[model samples]
Target: MVSRVLVPMDDSETAGRALRYALDVHSDAEITVYHVVGSPSMMMGSAVGLALEDDIETAATERAKPVFDRAHEVAAEYDTEIETQVGLGHPTRAIVARADDYDAIVMGCHGEHSENITRGFLVGNVAKTVFERSPIPVTTVR
Candidate 1:
């Protein structure tokens, strides 16, 4: 039985769909909504700005609050509650590293930053990497 399920999410519609799918398909399992705050880089991206704060961990959590809030709202729709986790660094690595603790992983096929209109592929690098490298079974929701 899948007693624990991990659902990685971003602020994307597909991520929201993936969470709903997990809730519906594994109604009895404990769900964890995981979000990774990418490490700070010279690019000055969102995560980088957050990581530059005095309390990096706290900053990451604060950044992830909205995503978790949305997840909670989604869970409420199913009359269920879900746990949330925040991690730092590469998303694929963070997710795959934690996958061993869960029975299965469910995530969106792609993420908000991965939409490439000019390119043919829609799958995000993180999702593809996690699907290939995860130690447990993975389900991808469109």
Candidate 2:
């Protein structure tokens, strides 16, 4: 039984679809919708722009809040319990680390590949990383 399901969402429509699919398949479970704030290492900033790095990270986290809020609203249709969280680090690693805490993970394999979700993980780097490292079951959505 899937006691909890976690999905790492972006602002993409694919993520929206994945979350919806997760809800339908795992109804009545507690779901955690998470968004990983990109770490400074991922940013290509010059020495001058580095001064605003902290602010940029804060801004990124703040911007993800509303998208997760929408995810919360979407969870209501399935009569599921939902929680939202934001983390800072490599997206795939962070998600996989927490995957063990949840029974399964439901996510969009392709961040933006609308035509092919089957090969989504291969083409999409983050999904590939999570797929390789996830300790639990992974359901990839288009």
Candidate 3:
């Protein structure tokens, strides 16, 4: 029996679907919605900006607010409350690092950037990496 579920959320349709799936299937479990900011990029703009902030944690949380808000709305639809977490650095690494604390992980097969031509036919890089590397069971929702 899974008592703790981690749902990684982004501003994507599939992410919402994943959250819904987790809530519906793990009704008796504690659900936590996680959002990652400052993920590495070729330009490193967001990550660098966050690093420059005096309060990096606060900046990251503020950056993740919109996603967390959407997750809250979804939880409301389920009539359940969920905890929210913010993480810094690479999405895949951050998720994997947190995996040991949960019984399972549920996430979108792809993310907002899946529309990129290069990634159009593949799972989002972060999701794919986490799926492969996470220590706990992972379920991906499309």
lDDT on C-alpha atoms for all candidate structures: 0.90, 0.75, 0.89
Candidate 1 Cα RMSD (Å): 1.5
State the lDDT at 134 in candidate 3: 88
TM-scores, all candidates, are: 0.94, 0.78, 0.91
lDDT of candidate 1 over 55-137, digit per residue (tens): 88888998899999999999999999899999998899999999999999999988877754413676778888998999899
RMSD of every candidate to native, in Å, equals 1.5, 3.9, 1.9
Give per-residue lDDT, candidate 3, residue 77.
Answer: 98
Predicted structure with the largest TM-score when compared to the true one: 1
Candidate 3 achieves a global lDDT of 0.89
Give the winner by TM-score: 2 or 3.
3
Candidate 1: regions farther than 4 A off: 116-119
Ranking of all predicted structures according to TM-score, beginning with the best and ending with the worst: 1, 3, 2
Better of 1 and 2 by TM-score: 1
Candidate 3 residue lDDT tens string, 97-134: 99999999999988876745435555777788999898
